[model samples]
Target: MNNNTVDKSVLNTASVKPKVLLDDAPLSKFHIKIAGLTFGAHFTDGYILGIIGFALTILTPQMGLNALWTGLIGASALIGLFIGSLVLGWISDHIGRQKIFVFSFILITVASFLQFFADSAIELVLLRILLGIGLGGDYSVGHTMLAEIAPRKQRGVLLGSFSVIWTVGYVCANIIGIYFADSTNPDIWKWLLASSTIPAIIILLLRIGTPESPRWLESKGRIEEGQAIVSKHLGENIVLDRQEIASDAGFKLLFSRKYIKRTVFNCIFWVTLVIPYFAIYTFLPLILESFGMSSNHSTDFLLNIILLVGAFLGIYFTAKFSRRGFLIWSFVVLAAMLGMLALLPSTMTLLLVAVFGVFTLIMSAVSNLVGVFPAESFPTEIRSSGVGLATSVSRFGSAAGTFLLPLSIANLGIQSSMLILVAVLLVGLVVSVLWAPETKNLTLNRASKD
Candidate 1:
């Protein structure tokens, strides 16, 4: 309940590791488990969001809401997401990453099930707000955990793997939603929504045996606990330079003048990037409907498969090259693709539409940069906070995008909307080049210290 109790645990932890035990310690199974837990936690929420993309249009009519209202309800999730990111990120720093993980997972499980019971617009909005809270917390905790546990050399690639699971989750949701729609089972929609909880529950249960972040432990003056956690992954034989990595100055470290500029830049970057990405993604069904497509479910299924595959391949290339380099290249591709979208006619081209699928995946894949860079940009003390705040603020852009899409489509049509996307992507390109720092080779801890 108090710092004293926590301190007692840390003291005991620090005192127990025998110095002579240093030997060739193999990586613990718990280390691997953390990676899976991190991936699963982030993956589940992404899966749910992807499902909503498939369902947003279907449920709009069923729930007796119009297009604008449906978009607002979806936007509600972004609002809750913004609030949660700020709160939970600070909590991860103040409490611990493990605690946030537990709390968030429980909330997600509850919210996912709530989707099944919502019969009205108000109910859907409330449930979405709750879902957003859990989703926000997932990014904060999962990003921090992955950053902390990964080997320095493989950190970018390993953290990038989370993006891979994200694609998988999105694809799974799309596939499942389409499958249910194809079956004509009225109850299947609820089943699909509720199914998202399975991954969260499994991850939550697995997390029971997972350890806290070693960096966080050390920052809290729990050198022993931190060392033990580190030893679990690094082997007891490995000697760390500092036996005490704790600091009374954890909070100060993030807000110092040195890091304040980094914070401001990140805030701007996060808020803007999600606008175009989600504008296209969340309303893909509506966009397709404007093209005279009949079945929203089928379109979503195909889009998901295409985007998911593209995102994975993009991340693979990003890891293989560098985040900044890959992002620059991707923007060029996306810009060209968005331009091509302007040329797409309603009647003419199944093949052109198919080619458009590749662009959808490209955009989704490239957008991971929006998520990945924040964690790598700040110090351990503020890494979660930085990520959380960035994402939370960015949801404003997302909300705007969601709100604007209908209006944009109304006045400008799909081609104009696609042109607008091209413009937004162009901004992303410029900001990424001018403002966002290249974090391809940096770690939060190391970067913060520099």
Candidate 2:
């Protein structure tokens, strides 16, 4: 409870090997349950975020939104996500992951329901910001919880499945968006936004009795409680091996010499990945139109299906290869695809579509890796904070890209914009080669210590 008491446990932990009892524990029903709950949260996040793409299409004409207003409406949630992840992520470290985890879904549900009543653009943007905050909090907390609980051998696959399940949510939203694209009703966007509440409610219900992270408990010197939770999930046969207990260095520690490299890696890689990713996917309808494809809901729906397939491939390969290897190759491939899109003649419809599909596939794979790395890179004491900062920073990039992309396309044209994204991916590829630490098969404790 106090610093003095926590210090005593720190000393005690130093002499022991600190074996995380659940590190190699067999997959159990509890793991599956928790995975389902966390995955549900991700699914909700995807739907909430993805639905905005179509909603904006409908809202723009109805509201007579100019380019600036359109950009602001699009970027509002991402800005909220930036703030939420930065603030709540740090808060979760002190308060506890479960409380933040549960409350976020509640917040999301409330926000989603409120969206149905929004009549003005400002009101809708405000509601979206609130929703984004909840989503940001869930992103950091859910991934950290999953990383802390999963077995090392399967950690990459399990965490990476967040992207796959998120794609399911995205595809579902696209399906619904396509269905409603032709609706003449002014309130159809409201219905689309409000529908996010369904999964959020399910996640809120499922997370009712979820356990706290044992690593977090041990870090706080609540060893007995931590052990009890571990035993409850991993079985009583497991033993706690004491390892060096890093001090509960607060957020300041993220910038300390020991962690600065990891922090930089997380920020740079994540920002680069999300900037083009959010810009491209969030405005896929527009991008398709630029490519001379019919900018119909059907075309957008087909592209998302390709994205889903790519996400599934990402999940499978995340388990099969080294994190560093997969990410390096993925970035290289993504950069190449972007370059091709920039250079190839737009009149080559079949070739352009084929290239774009492969681009979505590889980009989704790398995006899954982006989600996994930040959670794996930090100690339990700062895991949520580290992930939060990375996520927040990435959201900023996404916001900037999403906001300015229309302007960029207007000024620079589609080919030139694609070239710029190609440059961004090349930077990411270099970072992956120079800085990506090998994280596959490492326990949370072991990975953090690296």
Candidate that would win on TM-score: 2
Which stretches of candidate 2 lie above 4 Å from their native place?
1-20, 244-246, 446-450
Cα deviation of 412, candidate 2, in Å:
1.9
TM-score of each: 0.85, 0.93
Model 1: per-residue lDDT, tens digit, 148-180? 666555566556677678778877877776666
Q: Give model 2's TM-score versus the native structure.
A: 0.93
Regions more than 4 Å wrong, model 1: 1-28, 182-187, 239-257, 268-271, 289-302, 343-351, 448-450
Q: What value of lDDT does candidate 1 attain over all alpha carbons?
A: 0.71
lDDT value for model 2: 0.85
Where's the lowest-lDDT run of ten residues in candidate 2? Answer: 237-246
- The local lDDT score (0 to 100) that residue 180 gets in candidate 2 is 92
Tens digits of per-residue lDDT, candidate 2, 2-114, equal 65565768777786653445778777787777788889987987787789989999999999998888888888889889988898899999888989998888889899999
Give the alpha-carbon lDDT of every model: 0.71, 0.85
Candidates in order: C-alpha RMSD to true structure: 8.3, 7.8
